[model samples]
Target: MDYLIKTGCRKIVHFAAAQHLLIGKNRQNGYLHALYKNGIPVDDNLIFKCDNYNEAAHLTEKLIRSGNTPDAIFAVNDMTALGALSTIKSIGLKVPEDISIIGFTNGLISTMSDPPLSTIEQHGYEMGQIAVRLLLNRLSKDDDGYTPEIRVLKTDLVLRGTTKTLKEDKLGRGLLY
Candidate 1:
């Protein structure tokens, strides 16, 4: 989202996941934080509780038809972003030209699209490896009670055919508590 703003995207539509979900909540927090830090006011209407493929298209279409066509669409995942991409193309609007898009979870299908989606790649394998190490280290400590561990996983923002050139691959991180 910060990248979108830096790339000249003013009106960004956020297709969010469920409020109760930690990942969704954290991502939304980051979105709001970026807007606040950048001095951009939040538009409640532009934020939708959507995360799936069909919902992405439906919300995107509804938004476009309402004349509140966004400058960019920040989808919760790659599939949802793809849905918005498909709808935007079908509606005769150009990606990034009309509305840029970015999504999380750099899945395989993300690269299969015509304009390979610009997505945040959560290094899941590294996360798993770190998690196992953390567990083992904790077990060796012989703690009497359970304690929580916090780890921040890094993400790679791969710029492909999505946003006009937000920059080369940039590094970011996600909080896992």
Candidate 2:
């Protein structure tokens, strides 16, 4: 969300997950925080509980038909983002030109898209390894003295062809400040 804001995107459409899931709530909260920090007002109509490919495609097509094309789109996952990308192109819009897109979960599909997708890499492999190690440690414990541990992993922003960055300098030149 911050990436989109920093890139000068004010009207961002978010493809969110269900509110009941903790991960979804966390992501939505982060999205709201980023918008607020960047001084961008939240447009209630721009958000949708869309986390899958079919729903994303349908909603995107509807938005396009309504002539409410967003400046950028932030989807819950790569598949959902891909669906939007396909719809946007089908409607004759160009990625990173008419609109920008970013997705969570940098899966293989992200790189396979036409222009490729910009996404957040959650380091799933590392997460799985950490989980296995944690489980083994707990299992090998002789007593209940071994306390559970929580490991935090950092996510990386992998930029690709489907998005653009517009960094404004102090002098308003194209150079990033």
Candidate 3:
């Protein structure tokens, strides 16, 4: 959001699976919270309730045809981001140069894009390793009064070719200013 505001993206399209899922709900809340904190009013049109790649592509194309193309787009996952990329290009627009596109889950496909993709790395492999280790430990302990514990993994933002950063001097230019 700081990046979006800094880059002067007035309209941002958000793609989510469903508000019922905790991850989806959290992502929506975070996006909206960022806009609110930046003093930008939430626009319902910018929010897409589908997370599928085909739906994202179709919806993005529709927005472009309707002359309501967004300055930026954030997809729930890399596959969906790739879908948006294809539609954006079909409409004769350049990534980052025209509209910045970002995605969650820094999967293998992310680095395969023409300009690559900027995404959030959730460290799924590491997470799986940890899960397996926990399970083995529990089995070795014979489930002897072991209490379940919640572990939170940190997420990192990996910047790549799909996004842009503006040069700022001193106070800089953005909605917050």
Highest TM-score scorer? 2
Q: Give the local distance difference test score of model 3.
A: 0.85
Cα lDDT of model 2 by residue, 100-175, tens digit: 9999999998999989999999999999999999989888897766986867689999999888866667887543
Model 2 gets an lDDT of: 0.89
Lowest-scoring 10 consecutive residues by lDDT in candidate 3? 168-177
- Backbone clash pairs for candidate 1 read none
Candidate scoring better on TM-score of 2 and 3: 2
The global C-alpha lDDT for each of the candidates, from Candidate 1 onward, is 0.86, 0.89, 0.85
lDDT tens readout by residue for model 1, 35-65: 8998999999889898999999988888899
C-alpha RMSD of candidate 1: 6.3
Cα deviation at 141, candidate 2, in Å, is 5.3
lDDT of model 2, residue 90: 91
The C-alpha TM-scores of every prediction are 0.86, 0.87, 0.85
Question: Candidate 3's residue-wise lDDT over 1-177, tens digit each?
Answer: 657766788788999879988789888887899899888899998998868789989999999899998999988888888899999998899998888998999998899998899898999999999999889877777566777765668988788887886666677643322
Which lDDT value does model 3 have at 12?
Answer: 89
Angstrom error at residue 140, model 2 = 4.1
Distance (Å) between predicted and true CA of 131, model 2? Answer: 1.2
Position 116, candidate 1: lDDT: 91
TM-score of 1: 0.86
Pairs in clash, predicted candidate 3: none
